[model samples]
Target: MPKMLCRCGKVVGLGEIPSSNQWMIISDTMITDEDWDDNGLNMSDFYKKMDIVVKCPECKRLYIYSKGFGNEPEVYNLEE
Candidate 1:
């Protein structure tokens, strides 16, 4: 599990955080042209930009964790 610091100086584990309403699981194959046109992005581009976001319960801050964006799976606090 990864640990993240909140904006209020509270350290919390990524896994322990409540993600019921703070996560999005996007699939490349499920993206249609309408969705692409709505977001002004292509499916291929979206596929490479998939990521997971978790929110800090303490300060209501967002923490984005990259999954397949050609980067390491690291936690990023929005406040930072």
Candidate 2:
């Protein structure tokens, strides 16, 4: 499971990733070839990416989460 820390230092559990229906697609025209080449990503690659909206229960702050369309490690550690 993944956890997120609020600015107030409150710990929040994000549980499992949401389903594909919850995903938001990025428009290809929003990204330029130069930007894609610099990042080694193309418009086609953007389809695999998504943004998840999360809210901190403690402070009510909203957060946008993404995995950069890659298999990466957790950004936050679990509390002992």
What are the per-residue Cα lDDT tens digits for candidate 2 across 21-73? 12254557766677657765654566555455456666656554465423332
- Assess candidate 2 and give its TM-score to the true structure: 0.38
Given candidate 1, what's the lDDT at residue 42? 62
Model 1 spans with C-alpha error above 4 angstroms: 16-22, 25-30, 33-49, 66-80
TM-score for each model: 0.40, 0.38
**Would you list the clashing residue pairs of candidate 2?**
none
Q: List clashing residue pairs in candidate 1.
A: none
The lowest-lDDT stretch of 10 consecutive residues in candidate 1 is: 68-77
> Candidate 1's C-alpha lDDT?
0.58
Task: Note each model's CA RMSD in angstroms.
Answer: 7.6, 9.5
Residue-pair clashes per prediction, in order, are: 0, 0
**lDDT of each residue in 38-70, candidate 1, tens digit only:** 765665666455666656667666656565324
